[model samples]
Target: MTIKPFQVQNMLRHYGQHLDQGRRMARYRMLLQRASPEDVVNLSQDGRRKQLVEKIAAEIMDSLMVSGSSNPVVLEIKEELEREFGFGMEFRYLPLEPELQILRKEGEELTEVVGEEKQTILQRFWRITLAKVNETML
Candidate 1:
């Protein structure tokens, strides 16, 4: 299934650092103020800070399936998010179900079979993502 656009916005709201860093930090804490007790359970699970932050990051990143296999920007995004937000785990893997993996592999194979002329959809997707990110940063 395609990733829903709302999910993208939610991820950005939860994790993206605003160009105004202090505003972004305030936004995150404001989000926590609305959390349920269960949601806040990670806060004191191991330590007061790092563990909780990593747990929250893992929870957010677990919901995504970034398609690239060897993109440096992916790591850069993760590092920047972690640094800017002062919370987040290192992105080591994206857990996809078997069906999702099969679909991804098929897409890669199809790209090879179709040649470079058939990449408008991917380009459009990237454009949309970048636009969303820029809007969020603002």
Candidate 2:
């Protein structure tokens, strides 16, 4: 799960030269729409799935820094997320975080509204829970 500010900082710091700021942002939005919100990862137990997701997040940020955009790499990572830990994968459009909420110069709110009100909680950031390996399966 994303810890909001830290991840956003990574994106800004790791902006790519290839995708251009607009395209990179577009892709980022797209991915987030397809991901789940995770504020903290539980690593005391099975942590492999969380590690995999974190790896993908880091690589995508790194790729943007190095390769501008790597759609193939992103897609491959998505596939792996589903293939290995299908049980916990989730996707949905999420509301903007408090940090993203802003009053525009035009006296309008920058936060996107859904239906009539903004979503109160964002549970849409991508995260994973590694399943315990059962002896029977082993």
Candidate 3:
């Protein structure tokens, strides 16, 4: 079984790129507090799972700096996370120009409703977790 996509997105939103480092760690810890045995069935020990998840979070956050979606490093991390917690990370590319314009317009409207800072958070969240990695990175 796969970890819910939204759950994985939540983790990245709190821990991934564009977040201040100081806040990221704290947020990561906060995120971990919500994790339960149901989230990671393979690890019988909570401590072990916590440690592993922390490491993976850091790795994913760091990898997001150099690579976006389809990043091999992130892909590998995804595999490991799936094995451990059943987390699922799916790749998507930036939309075509026309679609992108529409998305950006919508995102702008969303920003107005959600606040600019929150929009940035959501942008980074989707960028790190969904945007496909560049071909050069391969």
Candidate 4:
């Protein structure tokens, strides 16, 4: 099944949170800052360095979320997930509807809205899980 843009975004968010829970932001930053132009250029020449670059990129994307920049992180995460899962994913931004705003202001009644969001997120998680399975089969 084709993954929806929103689903990919949700996966990126979940992965970012997972990285934060691991407290690996500092290490990730150090790696990125220390990576030389030559190191980056030579990454294709060395499998280990290539893997390191991928890991660093993932971590940097996660760290960016901590810095209050979620867009770039979301983009990188979507790309990485597509690469790792071998599935096509895209992102599109649409303005939030007025109903959503009203729901947000509903306080306790917002539970229903929150529950719907959570359910959507869970559906995205399942898609990612299936993507992983599909990748393994290939």
Candidate 5:
């Protein structure tokens, strides 16, 4: 994703240190104000401050993710989100299925018998995955 230089700088101003250190107390105050009314007895305490702040951070990060913005600046913001509030995206690879593995092996053997370039199942899968990653990076 492409992002303007000024936009990146603006994001940097709001994320990282600004998120964890400066705006923390300000957000807490806002939360307190929104949670309780002037006429009602105020029950806001320091005990719930951490939880409230974390909830706010989670909501912000959720909005950012749902927006589908994946610029490098957004990645840097995600890093800060993870570091400061324990909220960010996670990528994981599940194991291949046994049936798929068998099919791949059979395909490799058939290609070898047909005088095509010989490659093990693992090697072919690696090449396919590498090509896909490179294609997406562009």
Candidate 6:
């Protein structure tokens, strides 16, 4: 089946939202770390902080399986999702738009440092595309 563009956009929005939530949770953890010893002890003792971190981590992981830029994991998930859903998928990783290049240089540099694994990149992109498609259809 063919996936639609709007579906992909929706999935991307969801993925971005979850990722932001995960980042916020991480920031909370950092803030807690910087809190006074008594505050840290109280928060740690409550167990909710630990639970929140775990929950957020799980959400991030789930979102990542569908949206992660990592080559291998994305490929694997794509393959699984496509098999389950029966659709052709594709993804394009164009460089950041020229206007945003300067702001995104560090991320671009990191992706470069990580290097592209061609087979894996293609596989993951396809899988992510499939996921976007599937999510949209639902």
Which model scores highest in lDDT? 6
Point out the higher-scoring one by TM-score: 3 or 5.
3
Each candidate structure's count of clashing pairs = 0, 6, 1, 0, 0, 2
Determine the C-alpha RMSD for candidate 6 after optimal superposition of all C-alphas: 17.6
lDDT of 6 by residue, 12-129 (tens): 8776656555655676799778988566443554376445544543443344543445755456655664465455343322232211010112323422212344444444544455
User: What's the true lDDT of residue 90 in model 4?
Assistant: 30
Displacement of residue 81 (Cα, Å) in model 3 is 29
* Per-candidate local distance difference test: 0.39, 0.39, 0.45, 0.45, 0.40, 0.47
Off by over 4 Å in 2: 1-70, 87-93, 98-138
Which portions of model 1 miss their true places by more than 4 Å?
1-63, 67-118
Write down the worst ten-residue block by lDDT for model 2: 128-137
Off by over 4 Å in 4: 1-22, 25-44, 70-138
Q: How many residue pairs of model 6 clash at the backbone? A: 2
Q: What is the lDDT of residue 72 in candidate 4?
A: 45
**Cα RMSD to the true fold for all candidates:** 16.4, 16.0, 17.0, 15.3, 19.9, 17.6
Q: Mind giving the per-residue lDDT tens digits that candidate 2 earns over 1-138?
A: 657998887785555332344454676798778877674455653466556655565444333323423465444543454465332222212233212221112234243334322222111212221121121122
For model 4, how does the per-residue alpha-carbon lDDT over 1-138 read when each residue is reduced to its tens digit?
A: 899999999998777556454456455577789988877543354565445555544433334423345564345544555465454433211132211111222333432224665355335533543343334331
Cα displacement (angstroms), candidate 6, residue 125, comes to 37
Candidate order by lDDT, highest to lowest? Answer: 6, 4, 3, 5, 1, 2
lDDT of 6: 0.47
Worst 10 residues of 4 by lDDT: 96-105
Cα lDDT of model 3 by residue, 1-138, tens digit:
889999999887655343444445666799899998789645557666555555554445543433345766566544543354333333222222111110222323421223564355435544444333322221
- Sort every candidate by TM-score, greatest first: 6, 3, 4, 2, 5, 1
Candidate 5 overall lDDT versus native: 0.40
Best by TM-score: 6
